[model samples]
Target: MLRTYKFRIEPTKEQREKINETLMYCRWLYNALLEQRITAYKRCGVSLTFYSQKKELPTLKKVCEEYKSVHSQVLQNVVERLDKTYQAFFRRLKQGEK
Candidate 1:
């Protein structure tokens, strides 16, 4: 079973803008990487491992920081989940599955 939680924060216009900007950039990077991985696997039956995909993170972190500046750590927190997700995907793939 799983659970969900919800919370709210009051952000100023500038802070809201920064958060949105950071999240958008994070989403773009995550999706592009996923798409690239998918394309690679389609071209070759063997899936590219997350262990390899992670080499891009330092660069991705730079993108996150460049847009939002002070909020980089918060943005990095979200992207980190994508990292773990990719790791799980590779583990499943190696086990002969999705």
Candidate 2:
């Protein structure tokens, strides 16, 4: 059996601001990772794997202050989301869907 539920949250102004900031961080991380992957592939025909990127999180945090504000799990999930998207895209390509 399976079940699902949807709920709404009413956060305080401060919480709202934090939520917005997290979303912005997520957007930035996604764009940066995509660009890095594209550049890597173009430069040497190498695609970065999720684990490789995940392992760089500490170094990335040290280099980018904004990343420090977000939770580690949140950032990891962002990387995972991109990986899943790429996986789906390649799977579609193999199926001649694009």
TM-score of each: 0.55, 0.90
Give the range of the ten consecutive residues with the poorest summed lDDT in model 1: 67-76
Question: Mind giving the per-residue lDDT tens digits that candidate 2 earns over 1-98?
Answer: 89999999899999999999999999989999999899999999999999988898888889999889999999999999999999999999999997
Residues 57-97 of candidate 1: C-alpha lDDT, one tens digit per residue: 66666765564353545545545666688788769999999
The TM-score measured for candidate 2 stands at 0.90
Q: In candidate 1, which residue pairs clash?
A: none
lDDT of 1 at 94: 94
Best by TM-score: 2
Shift in Å, residue 62, candidate 1: 6.2
Query: How many backbone overlaps does candidate 2 show?
Result: 0
Model 2 regions more than 4 Å off: 1-7
For residue 23, model 2's alpha carbon misses the true position, in angstroms, by 0.6
Q: lDDT: which candidate is best? A: 2
Q: How far is candidate 2 from the true structure (C-alpha RMSD, Å)?
A: 2.3
